[model samples]
Target: MTGTIENMIVKLTGWLSRHSIDVLRVSLGLVFVAFGTLKYFPGVSPAEALSVATLEKLSLGTVSGYAAQFVIASMEVFIGLTLVTGKLLKTGLVVMTGAMAGFFAPYVLFFTDLFPGAPTLEAQYIFKDIVLAAAAMVIGARALGARLIPAYERQAPVHEIRERVAA
Candidate 1:
């Protein structure tokens, strides 16, 4: 019975290993991308929740703010697409982790003081992005083709494959 249970566990683990990365990449990556988009396209998400005034403090200029928002969102979408395709999951995830922090930094550093009435807003925004960053790091460390990602199982290149076959 113990052996049977162990075998079942292994099978389940393998199944998850085969599927979870794809599942997470598409869903989570798309969500982040959508968020980045909504940052600029007003009413694209929940109404008035993200105030224009709050964004003004970034001091990057009106056009710069919108550009930053759209560019970040575009990157989120691009990364999500790549992750879903599994073409560059680690690179996408690593880039996204940095990007999320980059998006959150202005609010955490400058905008927090603007909203004395909403003390927790800064904390919540910062925490959420940090969690997203952690998730991105996990994906980066585990997905295939990620040699820098130590937990992944790396196979040799095609030339090496031919040599091993000959040996």
Candidate 2:
């Protein structure tokens, strides 16, 4: 029974490893596209105020209000489309990473208000970008020919191992 369970787990892990990248890309793309589109319509997006404020602060008051919100939303849509279509994926990943950094800034820059003691709902939502950004990095790295795992199993040579053991 234990052997059977282990076999099943291995098979499941293999399947997930094969498909996880596409899943990550598509799901993240959908989220970005949806949220970006929401920003275009006034009073539709819950994040407008917070996003605008963050942009304003980051821009030193030179950028603020609806204009900043719209600009950010447009960028999100562009990144989403690129990621979804697998067109210029590297660019999308780079942009998304930067955006995620900006997205996460409020928690640090406005800690007193955003966190106080525990995190606010808005902060919680923004925090999810950390995971998403990491996922994007994985996808991007793989797309650029990263070797996350060796294609074949590897073990140290017997003599090398013996020497180390002896030492």
Q: RMSD for each model, in Å, please?
A: 7.4, 6.9
Highest TM-score scorer? 2
Task: Show model 1 residue runs off by greater than 4 Å.
Answer: 46-65, 88-91, 114-118, 143-167
- How would you encode candidate 1's per-residue C-alpha lDDT over 7-98 as one tens digit per residue? 55545655676767557667777766666566667556441243333334444445344555555567767777666676776677667766
**CA lDDT scores, all candidates in order:** 0.58, 0.79
Q: TM-scores for all candidates?
A: 0.61, 0.78
Model 2 per-residue lDDT tens digits across residues 1-167: 87566555555655676778878888889889999999888778887888888989988998888898888899899888987888988888888878887888888778888887888888887888888788788888878887443222135565754453343
Cα distance off (Å), candidate 1, residue 123? 3.8
* lDDT for position 44 in model 2: 85
